[model samples]
Target: MNDIGTILGNEQFARKQASFGPGGNVVPIPRAKKNRQPPHSDTDRANVLPLPSTNIPHRTQSGLIPAHVRVLLIQKNTEDRHACRNALQQTSDFNVELVEAGNGGEGLHLACQDAFDCILLDCSLPDMDCLEFLGRLTELTSGLQLPLLKLVPPHKPELAIEAVRRGIHEFLIKDEDGHYLKLLPVLIQRMLDNRRLAHEKQQIETLYRTLIEHIPAITYIASLQISHQWLYVSPQIESMGYDRETWLSNPDLRFQCILEQDRTMVERAFAKSCETGELFHCEYRALGRHGKLHWFVDEARIIRNHSGQAMFFQGVIRDITDLKSMRDELETHRYFLDQHVQSRTEQLEKRIVILESCNTELCNQLEREYLVCNELRKANNLQATMLQAIGAAGVTVEESFIHPET
Candidate 1:
């Protein structure tokens, strides 16, 4: 037996017996303290054996095992195995199952067979070195698990460093003293917490990547330094006629693609926006990969600190060449239509003036004919009066009447 077992035996700390009733089994009571008399006061008795309360942080029974948190513990030492088991027993909140393996080969076998939340590996296993085992672990759990922690001896710090380079999560050293056993609980808790955090971080990153990918427009982030580095380019870079890595490496090339006429305007707007920490929007022409000129609309805003200083700019660029072309065509058609309508209106006005002059001439001719007719009627009346007077003076009446009739 180990030194821990020997000490427990000497202290007469018996494994308390428990009874299994219909409801379930009750927790075994710890051995009574020697030289301690029973308490007389109610408060003292309550303190001696505290009843389990609903307010306790941990449950009496372990919770259901989560699909993501199946732990595999691969330790060759029997003492380490027992320490881990005891630590898990203390943790009643989380359900963690252990898979023991004596060597790296057996560990790899188990890892391949099932998914795991975290892998606890010893650096000095019998079958293989830690580095080789880690390489194999990486291959086996590629796109499967998060990461694995390396178990090392207290004396070998170099082994921990090498294991970390091989993509281990963290290194744990075995302590010779009994204090190591006490620390096992805290270590296990930290490991579980780190695993959960890593999984959450990965999920958030994936969601962000998906969101950026589905956006219809091109999106990117650029630094505001004099050189203007491309901090992040969206996955749409390929459709932009440039690969992501090529654009990231070459800032001068990107600048060269900007139209010479609008480059100054772009720079001025960017500088003002950055200084004032305001949104900047501009339209400019860009040269595509095939040397074809395209109109591009860029909209960006300054990302600022609490003190209101610009840190960087994130923006999107859209190819507006087709839109601009359509707008120009519409404007041209509108101008031609306006000119045609004005010409037709002027011609109609001239024709109306000529028709009005013709109507005035016809009215003048009709007025002259009416005056002549009136004059003739007046002359005939005067002549008739003269003839009637002559007839009354006894002149030849028949000749005068015939002359009047002629």
Candidate 2:
């Protein structure tokens, strides 16, 4: 419901919509004869609609439009500059600030400010060649994406093709009646949108790199081939005493770092996982810089395609030297505990055997004593019978009890 001002603040917006008249040409509209309204303040200019085109730029869900899109118009022809300005002035929605430069030198100078979002470069410049200017601009914004729309004369379509071949972002054909001016805003908006998208993509990539670089482990992507070509390796690889470039360039460098004793085991485990599309996991000792042996736990999963064919490996290697030290220390303690318990068990078993032997010896001695007492009792009974027989014969028995000790 925002009222974007009509063209020139006098004509109705619908009047600017012209149809094809005769021989497939846009019909010209007559200007309204009404007195123009006074210039609007800055606040009113903020809501002006962009130049009308089939593709109208929509405001984002935040209901916010770009503050202003600064354009560097590099054209020496005063009439062309006036035409471009008049076309731009048609809208008030997204403010289009145009800065005119009569020659390539001034344009390049203005471009150095790095303030403009897009550039309108004329193929024919009075002072310098457009290509040379573009080259210098490229140098100025080496890692940046700036949209440059080249304006080509309708007669010299070859210039547009040449500029495109020479790396111009986009090109527009100029006609005598200035019909191409109608499409100017659309092309500029498209280029601006593309530039915005490129900026966002670069920011996302930077954020991803920052996260990867600061992590505790080395993350990598490797090809599934036997050579195991590395696609990407995190900057954390430097902690392992190898630079990222060295690790990525030389596929065998990782294996070379592994200790001779553990190299075969790690290789076999990795190969098996790669062949079977299984998870790869192995712990091995590797020689770091200055012959420092460190333990590392490497784990990876086989990334497969939709057809179940292995594609590559996405993996992480953690420096487990400290963790391995603690684990080995615990194992040593456990081994000593086991040894101590075994020795204690053997000692207890020996003591039990000796006690059993002593108990058997005591049982035998008690049985022998019982037999001797029984014999003595039998002897006493015999002596008593003899005494009774002697009493019948009037013979006295004296001290007839036989003692076994005697």
Candidate 3:
């Protein structure tokens, strides 16, 4: 087999030999001078013929070439070879390389060697039928991230459909006017764009998975209107007694998993939130797979579309059963303390009233005793005054009698 370098070298040698003669008899051809146009001039337009309007809807002037695209052309016809070259050259933006393979076997060999941006597969080859080629190609590129475009004859539309079913990106039919070549550039651009988009999507999915794995709370996205189906659930749902498949398969099963008493309140709050497009927050008990009940406080907000219609809800659920139990205990203690304080206050007031009544009776008794003592002292003084008067009068009479007798 001739390598590319050897083939190019041989072609250059043949061209040089054809230009000379054995007896020094040579044809003189003038070398054309290279044209140097002004920098402001439209130089590319001068170098290449413009593609027909039907072929390229718009001309690109951005001068940005997408990253190099590897193309595998598996057509055996010479016309197809020329047409493909013309199409690639007209693109002016894609770096397209042609790897010509005569049969599907050879094509599959090339496809397995390296990753390609797009594979332009000729459906009919001399050695293999289109179906066999597609089947083998499917197996070859099954795990690959590349896109494939199959080429087929115009009469067989059925093959195109089958090709699509086999995971081919798109199919093109070779026509008489070579219009199929025009579609190649557009197809190439689209494939590259799709590849870039696929890469970005994969990256986003990876980031989402990583975030869901490490986050502490249970996170999910659920539909707002249709059965409240869970579109996505974090890995934490497994710890909460539900897997992603189980949740997605039956959304109402989640309500059944909730404790019967809390189910009604949770459903009511959820419905209100969906209707009002407000934040939903509620504490509910979830029945685990083991029949143990765990409390969770769900906090979610409704997501709305551009027309202000509720689309879905996204949020987190936190375990708060312990906190709730503690709160109830604290409330009970507070109630007991309040009752005890109130009873003690009533008892103290009654004792104060009884002490006041006893003090008033003691004051009345002391007043009576003081009045009786004053009366007794007055009577004793009166008796003493009367006795003194009587004694003085007796002494005066005795003194008179003694004087008469003498």
Candidate 4:
């Protein structure tokens, strides 16, 4: 068998077309400077042309291609269908999965059953023609979910444009010498790149949705109305007195969550921020649906236009009931310490005054006792002098009358 027959086991090319030798084998043509254009045909006609065989296998399978890339090939010709499968598997970057269909009807059946990275359609099919298949398939993937790459006849410019308008990714012209086989890998690679980008976009959107549902704080968008109406509320709003729907739809309900004592404080800060278009922050108490009062930090900003008109309010509120409880407990402790210190200081001042008075009285009593002792000493000295003098005089008298002086 020749290389063409080996590529797809195609025997029609051997009988219908001529090759080089007397044995009559089909020669693989060189890559043409430019692929030959199709003979004059209606551009609006079907996309596929009758070529070789209609014998599609029950399920033609190959070694597993990469799980990352999957392609669906709907071609009736055995040669073209297998040719696409082989080229896609050989791609260096993609692990390509190629599912074949005998006709457009079979292709549609497989497409609806499962999802793929892309769809490759031959303009012609045996059961359903290419145009009908494309129209119906486009309707199936209306949101341009699955990218379509069509293999069209070389000169069908009109049909190609229509296919694009219907949201086909690109229409690559077909060649008779099988040159499109080399281009097929590249086209599918482009389609896969686009598909990956779109897949990432969807993932990001899903992530945002999940975060909105499970976040720890309440996020909201509200209009600056007298009722403090909410426009949008996150899932966490359920912790506050309302569900998301009730908070947004019932404007008066949100205000009801604010305690009567906190209404003035919250209103002042919120109103000031709205008027100034500044970021707002406040701590207030709220009544939860569970009949519990909780503290929250209301932080938000007034979104405004260039003209300084308030457009809306966007903000987050974190539950701070634990923090508030701690703060109040600390303040109470501080006040108690101040009172205790003041009482101790006053007691010490009173004791110091009593001690100073006792010290002054003790000094005065010691001075008077010293003065009394001095007077007694002076009187004793005078008596001793008088007695000595009297004894001497008596002695002189006694001596004259019988030694009495002794």
Candidate 5:
């Protein structure tokens, strides 16, 4: 009975229990604190527990599957650092590239320069306190979730507790015999998986917020429930002289502000959007708090569920009062301009006909003038011929009398 009890509660069994994790097949270590004995001498190695057999590490986190994980090991001790590097590199599942930083200051400097997949920070750094370094590292990340693991000495469980209180994801205790190094890769894998999921979620939220804020319009999510409740309204509600909180939970405020003449049209359009799960654009006038009629345009679409059912209406509403006024004024100017152009065209047509008549009379008068000038030229030519003939005959008669006397 003594032999059986001793075998069941041996150091080998304790080691096995201590190494078990939630993911590993081995049984987990109990939460109750227990005294740890000094390392056994080599002569007792005949009864030492064999290391757990693992073909490939179960290091994968929930959402991430990295081909190579970058690990920055900040350890002042050379032997411990070497053990950690070897364990990480020997992992068969994924490649680990180990980087060493001797002190906390250097670690902080290194951390700020590049984005690492996992950081193995020593809880007792030489240059600065490990807690300070952690805080500074967190500040530098600017709320970014990077997989960081703190390396604590096995003797100081209080430090580990404090790190946990300060929101450190996980911590490690360096084992002098290098047995603890084997667990590093699995811990890193788990951290990375957790970080990936957190990052993806934050990314989605940021994208949605940025998209809604940049639209320069009121982004809305309307519920189809009683009074057509509003689920959300963007900060642009200030443009309508209303607070964001008041309109977010209330539905009738906006409708009450709509001009009585335009309420039915807007309501019908809103109803159609709720029914069809299709948000259409529409323009309507609403009375402002100052008793001025403002024009607005609503454009939206419906959010549907997997069952092809309408869940809610999501869309943007914009103020188009200036545009509407400009369009109406342009139409008025166009109408007046059209009438002015028609009247001017008629008057110009009448003047053109009178000018055409004057042109015809001038043409006839010019033709008569051209004919009279031709007749005058003929008369002048005939007179000139008569004068020449008279002169020539007088000269001929004188010559004949001179010749008869001879």
Candidate 6:
């Protein structure tokens, strides 16, 4: 099959009718200069129309050329329908099976009978206003996404403009030689590619929303201003006894919910983060339904614009009431245990002082007893020495007492 450059060249050379301006007047075609770029190769033609740049998932089933496409061709004239069919057959990149309809009623009927990958609409269908037909078609297939490409006559650029205003996906001008028909395959491919991109984006958004809504924490986006106006809050906010709508609607409700004692701490942290463009983190207590106080760990960061100016805040709030209670309980236990240990240590210190005093008194008594023992030994030795002297002197007191003792 011929590529896009060959097709464009064929269309240009085959043109027989003069172009028309917005006033419906003839515009003379300029003759091509001899200085022209050489014909583009297949690779160059491929480069002329590349896929849009995006991070969406790869299109395995739908790419530059879909595998099989069912197109609804709505043109009243049989000759024009046949020409469109012939043009669609010129390409080898993909296969298109046409379902032809003579008028808008027949086209809508055929659309209801089955599904179509795209719709080829001619702006000049008989028996119906084109806009009315479009409105009816939209109503009938409200759930179905039908991408329509309108074919407008060269003299009726107003019709093309009006069709665009009415949300026509794409349009082409008709000509005498019907060379404009050759663009059908390329246009259809581009329209489908765009549709696929839109579908991928929507799917990604839905997946992310599901994940955020079901998680155990509440996610939020808010303004960085002191008022802290809420931009978005996840459905999980309901777990904290506040509805999502209420949290979003009331700008001051978030601050009001915070415990009075912790409001300053939260505000200070938020201010510091906004000034420095740093992470805002703080633990605070908030009043829930029925005046119940819950502890929360709020973590947020300043979202900045390209120039590094703070734009807004994105954050997550986790209910840490259970964790906070456990920590407080542990602290209380530690405090009491410390007091008990301190009391026991003081008692032990007093006992040690008393025992030291008793030990000193016992040591002094032992020294005095040692001195008395030394004196007693000296006295006994002296007495023994005197008795020895008395025996040597032959003592007369005992002999004088023994005369009357018989």
Best by TM-score: 1
Tell how far residue 42 is off in model 3, in angstroms.
22
* Cα lDDT tens digits for candidate 4, 113-170: 5566678888878877677887787687554447788888877767777877766776
Candidate 5 local lDDT, 1-406, one digit each (tens):
0010111110111111122112212111122224434544675543322322333345554336576566677878777776676666555556665667788777776666655677788877788888887788779866544566877766787887887777677776655565556567677776676666566656666677778777878888777775777777777777777777776655688899988898899889878876666657788888766677788888888777999787767778888888888999999999999999999999999999999999999999999999999999999999999999999999999999889864
Name the weakest run of 10 consecutive residues (lDDT summed) in model 3.
6-15
Which regions of candidate 5 deviate over 4 angstroms?
Answer: 1-203, 326-351, 392-406
State the lDDT of candidate 6 residue by residue for 29-85, as single tens digits. Answer: 222345643654676444332212223333234345456677778888988887887
RMSD of each: 13.0, 13.9, 12.8, 14.1, 16.5, 12.6
On lDDT, the leading prediction is 6
lDDT of 2 by residue, 13-102 (tens): 121222221222111222223454465577544443332234555433221325456677889888888888877665444567677878
TM-score of 5: 0.48
lDDT scores of the candidates, listed in order:
0.65, 0.72, 0.68, 0.68, 0.69, 0.74
Clashing pairs in 1: none
lDDT of 1: 0.65
After superposition, candidate 3 runs with Cα above 4 Å error: 1-65, 224-226, 307-309, 325-406
| lDDT, candidate 1, 36-116, per-residue tens | 434246653333321112222222223222322455677777677667666555543454556666677777776766555
Q: How do the predictions measure up, each by TM-score?
A: 0.73, 0.65, 0.65, 0.54, 0.48, 0.69
- List the pairs of residues colliding in candidate 4: 47-123, 47-124, 48-123, 48-124, 66-95, 395-405, 398-404, 399-404, 399-405
The alpha-carbon deviation from the true structure for residue 294 of candidate 6, after best TM-score superposition, in angstroms, is 3.0
Q: After superposition, how far is residue 334 of candidate 1 from its true place, in Å?
A: 0.8
